[model samples]
Target: MESPDRTVHVAYDPYVIPGGRTIHGRADGLNGEWSVHLGRQTSVEIVAGLTDGLTRPRSAHAPNV
Candidate 1:
């Protein structure tokens, strides 16, 4: 089992805007596809929505959500 204290990463496609780079839409309800040895909850879900990032749209360099 994985510890809740540990954080997991999620990624999605990025889009270009008139101002800068950002996600075209919300990345919510996608955590269900994540798996980090979360034994009891192999398919745990998040009730919140993810914000759009300009620089790092992918999970590689995400700052604060």
Candidate 2:
């Protein structure tokens, strides 16, 4: 994904095997934030523009760190 608060366009290439379409849209929000899961080993949450804010999500089976 590109930077936030900017317009982005995406197009899927067709004719190779199947078919697809293009999508265009814009987004406006506070800042970018993301949560990623790495298999069943761990999960990570990150707030854009800063690494100090990185963290793991709370879970019933996981102990607080």
Candidate 3:
């Protein structure tokens, strides 16, 4: 998945690394700023949940509710 403006991107690829899957990210189209190696023993659902929280929008103040 990517940011709405497309300056940031995150992806998961199992084949890019030899022993395990990876979640890699970059900003401004530059070289990867960071990566998380799931170490061959993680599930897609967990990854999805993580990335969802990572990319989800946020607000400075709490809602009234």
Candidate 4:
């Protein structure tokens, strides 16, 4: 799945394959740099929520760090 603006991309694989990655993501940052992320054996619920959040629009208000 990808964001509406095509700035973010994510992939997930639930199958258990040896040395196979479970999740991969690429995003274009505000700083004009690209970021990559990888995950293995991550929880389904967590990945689901991450995908869900990426597909939705961000809030106008900044989040508390």
Candidate 5:
């Protein structure tokens, strides 16, 4: 189990565009493809997906719809 203050990482395949445009699409509804154990006294619920870095559109990266 990880602490609430711990960092949570979410993996996703991003769309890419020419010239390195990057965008992070919104997380899938519910995002319930996986689960995590918070702790003995805590439970896991409503897990949201996310990207590794800022979810901004980077022309040099890829286009995320």
Candidate 6:
């Protein structure tokens, strides 16, 4: 994890919903399971110009799409 001040390991918890995916704590209105991409590029995009944002490190318990 790279921060503006420094870098550290950050943990994020994500879940799925009907409309779009969510980033647990930082963001809530994000696209849920429907837009989650498994092995391909997804429609979801993180905050622009910001290095710290939602990223798929692993499967979010399978994409509902």
Tell me, by TM-score, which candidate is best.
3
Q: For residues 12-47, could you state the per-residue lDDT of candidate 1 as single tens digits?
A: 323322222122322346543332112222222321
Best by lDDT: 3
Worst 10 residues of 5 by lDDT: 16-25
- Can you write out model 6's per-residue Cα lDDT over 1-65, one digit (the tens) per residue? 33333232232324432323222223235633322222222233343212243343336785554
Error of 1 at 3 (Å): 24
Worst 10 contiguous positions by lDDT, candidate 2? 46-55
Task: List residue ranges in candidate 5 displaced over 4 A.
Answer: 1-32, 40-65
What would the per-residue lDDT of candidate 2 be over residues 1-65, giving only the tens digit for each residue?
A: 42343344334445433444333444437434332322222222322212222222456875644
Q: What lDDT is reached at residue 7 by model 3?
A: 42
lDDT of 3 by residue, 1-65 (tens): 66665544555555665555555566445354676777557777887776776566755683632
**Tell me, what's the RMSD of every candidate?**
16.8, 12.7, 5.9, 4.1, 16.8, 14.1
lDDT of 5 by residue, 1-65 (tens): 22233333332222332222122233456533333333222212323222323332366766554
- TM-score quality measure for candidate 5: 0.15
- Candidate 1 has an lDDT of 0.30
Angstrom error at residue 21, model 4: 5.3
RMSD of 5: 16.8
Worst 10 residues of 1 by lDDT: 35-44
TM-score of each: 0.15, 0.22, 0.49, 0.44, 0.15, 0.17
- How far out, in Å, is residue 4 in model 3? 5.2
Which clashing pairs does model 1 show? none
| lDDT of model number 2 | 0.35
- How well does candidate 3 score on lDDT at residue 9? 55
Compute the lDDT for candidate 4.
0.55
- Residue 17 of model 6, lDDT score: 28
